[model samples]
Target: MISKKIGLVESIASKSNGLDDIRVKINGEIQRAYNYPKLTGEVNIGDEVVLNTTAVELSLGTGGYHFVISNLNNMESNFTPGGHIMKLRYTPLQVKVDAVEEQESPYHDAIEEFESLENMPVVVGTLHSMLTPFVASYKRNNPSKKLVYIMTDGASLPIYLSKNVDTLKNKKLIDSTITIGNAFGGDYECINIYTALITAKEILKADVVFVSMGPGIAGTGTKYGFTGIEQGPILDAVKKLKGMPVAIPRVSFADQRDRHMGISHHSLTVLNDIVNVEVNIPITTYEDEKLDVVKRQIETKELDKKHHIVYINNKNTEEDLNYFGLSVRSMGRNYQQDKEFFDAASSAAYYLMEVCDDSRRENY
Candidate 1:
């Protein structure tokens, strides 16, 4: 049974993109809570609300916030038109979306006509923080290119939870978004990653595609036991569809953990042991002892021999980010604090830019 508790809303902290961050008092204790206005409608001060406290009760690292289940004052249900197929089936909020592959879907013809990704460059990253830097850098270098983001359900289920995504879309950094596999709230909804990729190529007419989870990646501090393991299969999916797979290696020297330093264990594990397909791994030029550490890790894992390791100069990434008026942070560290992290993502974008330019020259 799920543990739930009734709480009184003490104050509304902030509201954005259909989510409300509120302060609540439950059993004489103050707790932070998140409320989805789409489901429960708008909540207010002094309203009594029911919360799913299972994660918080277990001290789970679910961002340390309880989820607002329902407000006693508002019990109205909100429904939208969708197909017969249901995602999250048997759950209370189980929803049917008009998946593009569905026969009854309006996009069925376009989806059927889509034969391949046409060697479209798809950048796959393990963290949501990788989204902004890559998109901003790509847009800065090639302003005319149309980029689409395909968010997988490996992390946060609700796409609205990502404030970075909202900022990127508002600034026109990304052309559109598609949420797949039980993740909700995007410009379009797809049943799976394959359909999402097709939508990017056929419908959106995107020049490049970026794939990552929303936010709050789950890690168990053990090899092969993290949510980011999905990157392995996603790389395979892109290759099977004839798309060019450019992997964003999660590089960091600021992290205190040994597992996360240099090329993160997550990236090494996925690339070396998990993903079987050949992927383009880009490493940025950096002058530091940590660079040697990363090189040793790559050589030891045989990543250089297995994958096409490309060296890129991302020295201008800071300039591009500044031009777009965007600042990004991962694990609470900014660009200055975590330069290698952002540089790794920017290097992938740089590689894509070169590929696009080369293709254009050939076409001309």
Candidate 2:
């Protein structure tokens, strides 16, 4: 399943945290590649490296970059300290992380002491692209709210693979990050979504939490094949833990694919077949014709019977993104090309903040 080749590092692109983006010459051509210093050690110019070239060979969604499997010149990698929990378990690259729920963790007692989320607002979206608009709008509207991001292993296994995440963190748009399942490289690690949610509230003291996978979502044309289907169970987990769950519908009028036009069939399947609990779904305010299309889908699928569908006015989404200087895209389409897709996220973010505030007032 893996394709490998020997490459010579030609130039250094950039280094941030544990990730190094470099250009390597393979097969007489210079190409982009990524090296995780923690996994393969720091790469240097002129160093020989083993690259996993499968993604590029198959034209997969790896952003046209190969992955450095190992640095031949710097063969030794230092092991990180603490924790018995192993993520990427049983793999050659398996890493031991100090998960927040482990017995040896400093927050272990707090994690065990967890009761309920106490109605902490948890916004759930199926795509990594949803993060930018959601975060920008929510932070713009509620600047003081602590937003913790939980990256699940539905896509990329390493959190460093997402430049969006690094940019958000650098901008302070995201307060903290928690990686769950096999995903790693975050401020904190958790064994699963359950502890990740606990860590977001109980430990990070976040006012709201956003859950999505890292970049590069997997998809197939079939009804049950996309990685975003994880959104269903994620919503269920939020409800089961007594957290308020708000779902960002996958709305797009720009997509040429019929299955993805009004509301993606993937989302339709999740809300219809997978999610077994009540979840709030937010859609952006649109013109009558566009609104009618979404309304017809909701009625046809009986989505309203199972979930709360709220229309939120997210008219300033593009302006909000521009104000924050955050560039976001999905399926290679920018905000202008795919307005509704982005609006869905911004609308959900606004509604989530409102619901959180209303809940707080009721309790007060």
Candidate 3:
């Protein structure tokens, strides 16, 4: 019952890391399509391609692009060495990956050795864009720290879709990556967030961990209908594992929507009602008027009672970003356009530094 269509490749827009963003002509209509070269091989113009058009037909946000299922011109498949555990099962191109927690996995011993996170700082954010600022800020302050990124499957499935990850990895801003759930193409593939956390602490020896989805977060403009709701469960998992959960609040004054005006409804809803465990929510210092909106939201939602609301000065976040030569944009707004959003992430990073310093003092 899944909607599919056969199209002709009109042109290739861009190609990177075995994925292609291309234009296809279907039934005399031009449509955008994503082609994974590893699956269907490199597609060329005039090639007939099969596409999954269900999402595009429904006009779903963040799911508008059609996926190339097969190329009539290329009918070869490549099977690589991985575990028997499959992701995107029952579908074409279902991949077998070596999940670290699996009994037959080579990294299985690492999980047994892992007992606790040892209060390792884990920064949880709702949006993918938050990863850059948080990691950039933390790396700028703690240059020697080893940071690991754990990406959940709440958004894009392939880690290659994230240019930020590519940039951060190349620049050594983040030490490694772990993709969880149906998401694939990380340095290491994990079955879920829990194992990914353990891998970060035990095997990767991560000093700090950043958890978020890849780019293109889906929102339905209704309560509990957004992809960002995953933040609640991620925070719970971090706490359940004895890791320090530092939440990156989504604050934006530049946004035109009222629900996301001060502290985003996404963050507020997750902290206020969804997450059961207490987390550290960091708010960057802003003007009293701007800060008032956040304070009012906290009071209205009683987030203060549920979570630890910490105020931090993140005025130097821009400098940290510039120091790393990193430029980030969220919802089409640049750092200057969305200062509150970036600062909120940076503040969480700053709080992690405080946690690390406190732990070091205790050890000394």
Candidate 4:
């Protein structure tokens, strides 16, 4: 496709009779070389144009000295005599960055905790795209909880866990061998629904599992990630497991965005129709504390329980949220929202492990 950038060299907006006419300069030498007549009254001075000759049409609204041309990559944009110069950039509909640092992470709280744990709990999250860091941490800590990870790409877990065995043992987190598995799939397919069922099973087995992966830059939206999957199978899966499904959204640096709603928060609403487990949804807003209120309501059962949905108000203020790097986007609202959603997912996973630990001990 011929990528094009249109720019307005010059323009003058004027009214003749009842009609409006705009005149401007065109910079594309190709236009003159191709014997194309100059665009008359179509633009004004210092206007910009952007279009791809083979891709999409250039649409400039209102007054501007606009001109269209192909091959923006090879040339620099400049102003014309009658119109303003224009620059063009390419953007994809969806792009995901794993951002796995080759160097060690500067933050070491999780690592330190894992190193100190005698029985490490399994941490679960949606997607296997960019969890190299966590996996590495587990290996380094070598927790006894098997350092198990449930991922969408289930086929690959066995291999990944095996490779990390040495590190896992060295961290002294594992008194025994660690194992990982892919129950459903290995990727982030049907995260909310799949995890609800998986958590149920894990609970029945007396295993603690943590869940993360909310709406975020992780490219796992509700529609394509977890909540969008079929409800019937999800229900069946949870029924087979016979355990409660908790929704805990983490407010973390790895996740924090404004473009999308929290996946865990949304899961509460969506999963209510799918399963019967007790949910731990967190409600976050830009203003007042939302999750704390929800948590109190849940404790009092003041919130409607006619459905299985429950919202846990996080006792975090906006400032606290930002302190954890859970701030919304100053510019890219969508990206920031997505980040928040995913962070919630990770936090939910961590919380689940804690809750499960307590539940298992009580039952034991």
Over 1-364, each residue of candidate 2 has an lDDT whose tens digit, in order, gives: 8889999999998999778989999989999999988888888899999999998999877445799988999988778778889888898888888888878789999999999998888999989999999999999988888999999999988999898999999999999999998999999999899999999988899998999998978888999999999999999999899988888889999999999988999999999999999888998878789989999999999999989888887798998899889899899999999999999989988887656674552431
Which candidate number would show the highest TM-score if scored against the true structure? Answer: 2
Worst 10 residues of 2 by lDDT: 355-364
TM-score of 1: 0.94
Please give, for residues 220-318, the per-residue lDDT of candidate 3 as tens digits. 899889999999999999989888888888899999999899998888889988998999888887989999988999999899998888888778889
Report the lDDT of model 1 for residue 194. Answer: 90
Candidate 4 yields a Cα-based lDDT of: 0.32
Count clashing pairs, candidate 3. 0
TM-score of each: 0.94, 0.97, 0.92, 0.33
For residue 95, give model 3's deviation from the true position in Å: 1.4
Name every residue pair that clashes in candidate 2: none
C-alpha lDDT of residue 199 in model 1: 93
Write the residue-wise lDDT of candidate 4 on 1-364 in tens digits: 3444454433344433212233433454422111011212223345444433332233321111222432232334332342111111133211121111112322223222222122223343333222322333223322334333333322222122222223323444323321112222112222233333332233223243333222122224453344223222333333344434343322322234442222333333334444443334433332235445445444454324633333233323333333333223311333244444333433443344334454443431
Report the candidate with higher TM-score, 2 versus 3: 2
lDDT of each: 0.87, 0.90, 0.88, 0.32
Error of 4 at 144 (Å): 2.9
> Model 4 Cα displacement at 159 (Å)?
9.8
TM-score of 2: 0.97
